[model samples]
Target: MAEIQEKADSGKGGKKRAKKMSVHLDMTPMVDLAFLLLTFFMLTTTFSKPQTMEINMPVKPDSEEDQSPLKASNAFTIILGDDDKVYYYYGLVEDKPELNTTDYSANGIRKVLISPRIKSNDKMVVLIKPMDVSRYKNVVDILDEMKITDTKKYALVDINDADKELVASKTGG
Candidate 1:
């Protein structure tokens, strides 16, 4: 708000002189506008909540070693390799078990994870083995797939010698 107040020719030699004026500015509307903008931003903006994934880790045995062993029949092994290559097989690599190749797509790993065999077996466990040549993104992708499939039982284990030999025989490395 603005206003101009005129003083009635306050000069001693008042010979048809112009009126002296002073301007007054009110800041109430500016403050109201600021508050309105603040409230609008506060109400419309979305606050980010801290998101965390629940990781199930095996507990260390105090007296004896880990007694409960993972069942072989319900194991689903996934191997990540170079050039975004993904391989998988059911159970252990028993002298060159067919290493099926798949990608990190909806039709690739997702379909395999949500297959009928996996869904039917309630105790199905996923074993993710990332090779030295594979990128960290591959492991993250597999973990995300596990989350998508609602899988509770899974492990990130190192590649064994038998697995390496099987892979070498298949890839002719």
Candidate 2:
């Protein structure tokens, strides 16, 4: 709603001059409508739910006899270290696993994970060992890469002494 007021003043010669008018605008109703719309939208809209990645952890064996050995040819190991360094090997470390270094880029670890040999092997497994010096985000990113590469079998294992030594020798730690 709006209103206009007019005022008349007498000139110096006693003649009446043109009326001066001022306009006022009422914004209370408009403000109330805006608030009501905001509340309605807020109440009717649905918020996004949190997303989570599913991880399958292995169950502990009851005895040594219950454990099964994994084949070296079907294994791939990834070592995560500080400064975004990634070291990978094709098979068991006992066979003198030739450590190759790569990064987290699309053409780096992803390329290795999706290679024809690894992808075609039905029993292929990925072993991820995150060192103490590695950042939390690096672990998460590696996990995400595993998912993106659609690796069916992967495990998060501890950094062993041999692995620590290899990393130390390679990175000059």
Cα lDDT tens digits, model 2, 55-167, are 88889999999988988998899999899989999998878878899999999999999999899998999999999999999999999999999999999999899988888
Query: lDDT tens string, model 1, 58-134?
Result: 88687656466666788889989888989899986763567888999999999999998888898888889999889
RMSD of each: 3.6, 4.2
- Residue pairs clashing, model 2: none
Which sections of candidate 2 miss by over 4 Å?
1-35
Best by TM-score: 2
Off by over 4 Å in 1: 5-22, 40-46, 63-65, 161-165, 168-173
**Candidate 2 vs. true structure, TM-score:** 0.78
